[model samples]
Target: MSLITCSKGHQNPEGSRFCTLCGEPLPEHNAFAGGINTGLVEGTRLRDRYMIKYQLGQGGFGRTYLAEDTGRFNELIVLKELMPTGQGTYALQKAEELFQREAAILHKLRHPQIPKFWELFRDRKGLFLVQDYIEGKTYQDLLNNRLDNGQSFSEVEIIELLQQLLPVLSYLHKQGVIHRDISPDNVIRKEQDGLPILIDFGGVKQTAIDVATQLAAEKYGGSGTRLGKSGYAPDEQLRLGSVAPHSDLYALGVTAIVLMTGKPPQELFDAHTMSWVWNRQLNLSSDFNKILQRMLAQRPSERFQSAEEILQQLPAVSTVPETRVQPHLTQRQITSSNNNFIPPSPAPINTSGQGHLLDNSVEVPDEIVGWNWGAFLLPGFWCLTNRVWIGLLSWLDLSVVTLGIPTITISILLGLKGNEWAWKSRKWKSVKAFKRHQRFWAIAAFILWALFLIIIIGVILFAIAIAGFGM
Candidate 1:
């Protein structure tokens, strides 16, 4: 049988519509007959260089195609077209503008985890953007495959994934860009290095919003447009049309939770209480849980202020030395002496009981049950030490909103209650050590308070001297 090579390098029989191995479509034999005059088809070459292999995917705004750059040793690339479906002249114009914007944005971005822009041009077929093709499956596909095998991502794997991906998010944020859509479907794990590459920029959504607003003003004399995936996007991005770096963090948190439990955000979130219920189903370390809670906070202000902050909170997983252990002693018992040690292999989860999935043999500390005086005294320090990033952000937000007037009171309250939250969320060597740490922070808080008072008195006396001179 005659053979054909799919864009993904899968070989299939000639006349086959799809590759048997990867399920990618094969280019039609006569696709290039009409050339640019008949739209993008198999074998059709653009700019006398890129050869269209087959269509990859399509949406309302445009279509993505798998193509080969013939001028560059037939290197695989993705070709994006700005062909708005069923839209009038105005909508088409807006799409073209956004397409240019996406190209510009991609051109300026220089991250290993982001696709590199190759070229942007218009031909008889219409506008097209060429970018490096990522050879990998989307996170959604990975999640689905794992679910099909009755396996879900472990806490450690999720943490590692976050560590690998957050830097990319930080890079984007530093460049003054907000990836408004950060769902599992938009992240691809590269086959070469298993590194997650973020795809699908939603800045075009801004153009869509403009088009919708214009249409609304022409019809009902109003303005508004809805953008973002449900459950993944925060309230501000969905309702108020406001997006920030934290908005992407919220979606990232949702993605992590979904990977952990293999459940959709809609199913995990409880609308009645406005909280996520997935915690009840999964056995996660307190610190990890706290980080996720902050990431998925209802208010953007309560979420991690930046990706770097979340990275600070993530527990470092050390590589355990490979050593044969006596059958009598379990891995937990062997590592009991080392407080920072994490077992190379995680114990299987026991779903038969109400307790955590953690092994019973392991003596993990329980979360604190009551108020934390140290937190009330030094909220910022306590949060920094305990890795409760949301608490720290909350303190900062309160200070800013209150114009620093309520700072002392807020600090006092945080000191009173911070230890409880911190202890519950953090892992320490022992209760005694945790208490000692809190006490140290409390002393620091006292010094901070003293400095604050000194500053206030200095300002007051200076003002008094100025008034006396005026008299």
Candidate 2:
């Protein structure tokens, strides 16, 4: 089961929905928000080069090993072994052909949602395909956990899931690459970003299966290793062994329904009737319902043609994360009662390295936000450096007429609102970089302020001495 860490460092299962020790309402667990489907090792070297750590799994193709690339400072990698035992002479030929064509293209595939394909090499033992190792639980794992607790994914979850995953398919299809296999097991909700990363591309699987199927037919006189999973894959791809862009769409639609109902494809699909019987099991919005239905349409031509079509039709901005309530009030909320005073930073949202941006919103990160000494000390000058141009309003002469009340008020306002405004106004390379820049200015401001105070005190002392001497 997947676990979530609470603020107090308590690890809680996702299903528990709260910190077992603290009883704090478990944070909204959206780890696999669009999870339709679906690592690490410190040890092991392969072919005297990659260090093998652990055996991930095994099947007709061969074994998968978690290995470390010593050359890359032991960066984690996944090694898929293709062992078509006793496939005779044609084994290497078939492997070479498939890997050269599919692996070549996949290696060139660069996308945030897909793992970086490393290399495909053969050895005395067998063939090995390498790729980056992603760390996380598959949607399937999460679904199983939920099922263990007598709950399935909700409608909202599926909707958000589609919002996240469809774009990945669209990119693949545009590149003329078909995932071939896209079950919950193939999609992983990355531990780092909480985004869905499509993994286990069908290319290697297909290559292994092709040779495996040949061996099966020649020896056992049988067929095996269908590229797409039963029920999850449409009839045509599984039966014909041919796939198109829509083939992936059909499989994805099946994966979605399975996630919602917490049931496998075998139970959800009616083979005898050649139709889906999942509607009675769960309630979904009509719009999303229609979208899934069209995606699952049995005929390739009948289904939505592309992932783009489905994405364009999915429920709108509902997938966008809801704005978090910061302790600070928005600009419009500022008031004269001092209740409008800017808030002190709230506890962090536990999003380190997540890089949540406030680009188009007022959301302030708890850690990198709060009173800005630089802005408060030198509002007019600091505004230019931080690119918060509007802050130059501190230069307004209204302070002169108000006996410095307005100037002091503006400075306080700058102190309170500076971080948020600067964050939104400028393009920062990173949160750390932004913090560093602000720290530098703050030190400068403090040094300048200290010098000014020292000078003022010295002048006052001299004036006092002069008055005493005159007396």
Candidate 3:
């Protein structure tokens, strides 16, 4: 086979479109040169080392290209260009300064969840920034795929995502960098480890804001443009042009809700009432629901003060209580509060051949009152064991709404009224019979609860494995 050397000087087999080591496309010797006059073309070598293969994306501030580092054996890298549109000489200078500042911030960040910054340079084309190219799909792509498949993220999945990503946010906050833009599009879930990587810092918008302020101080500015997603950005950030760490939290909260409901933030938010109406679409654990609500609060003061505070409020999956069977109570005469059932008094009954009266009375124990822990802890199993059809249906309904999160209130109510429902469901000949049946079912309920827990754990592990495999 014949050999061809790529622009990065990597020799490869003939007819290869891209370099094996660096992913740079090999230029065709007989290819025509006529193309769009953007100054950048296929196989264009920049800085005498980096080779641009193709453009990745473009925004208001700049264009991004997938390039290869010839110095590093054609290793893949991203080159971002600072091509400010319709800006004059003075504005362009400010933009360049902002770009440099962004580069400095990126250099200071040292987290596995963030992309590594390489170097900043300026050429005849424009200002350029070289950085590591992460291999993965954005969260927005993942969400869209799920929506296309007629499925959405479950509460547990969203919670796990938040748990995994919040620490990165906390790390950034401690370093004095507020990620002004934190929408789903900005978060990439790496294919190898299923870890999220935050990308696309708001450098361009920040630069614009700085320029606007500077010009305004000199009486040459009109109005500064806002720099965040409309639905995800809080009022303070969107209206007042003030951003804080908590601002990122608001966007994260909106992202979670969007993932959970498979609906846009605009649809979920009610501008008339100035509150989110997402609660009606999904059911979530009380703690999680409260945390998201506070995070999405209209006022930043009403939200969590820090990421650590939000972490503390997240639900712990390992704290699920082990099911315990309650002890059976033997025959005892009972008095009803709403009914006039007379309590049995002490009576003597005789024994032996002659008809005799012996003590047939037993002390009545204190009434079982208040909440029932068994029902509260294991609602589905508790209902199934007790054969409460209504309870089972209610639990199933709630599970569907909350994306399979068990309803604590329903569980608690079941625990409080479980015994009463059991007694009313069947006709018992004596108190001893009722006690025997109740004890048997209690043991059965515990067994069912154990099986339920095992199944849930297995499903979670399976999901994690699939996610790790990028399936």
Candidate 1 per-residue C-alpha lDDT over 38-127 given as tens digits, one digit per residue, 9 for 90 to 100 = 246899888889899998864323557899998899999998765432235555555567667776877899999999887678765366
- lDDT string for model 3 (400-438, tens) is 567644466566667776656544443233345445555
Off by over 4 Å in 2: 1-44, 213-225, 317-471
Lowest summed lDDT window (length 10), candidate 2: 29-38
TM-score of each predicted structure versus truth: 0.59, 0.63, 0.59
Q: Between candidates 2 and 3, which one is better according to TM-score?
A: 2
Q: Model 2: per-residue lDDT, tens digit, 323-401?
A: 2221223444455456635444322222222222234434456667788998899888898877777667778845456
Cα lDDT, all candidates = 0.69, 0.70, 0.67
Best by TM-score: 2
Q: State in Å the error of residue 346, model 3.
A: 60
lDDT pick, better of 1 and 3: 1
Give the worst 10-residue stretch by lDDT in candidate 3: 348-357
Q: Rank order by lDDT, top first? A: 2, 1, 3
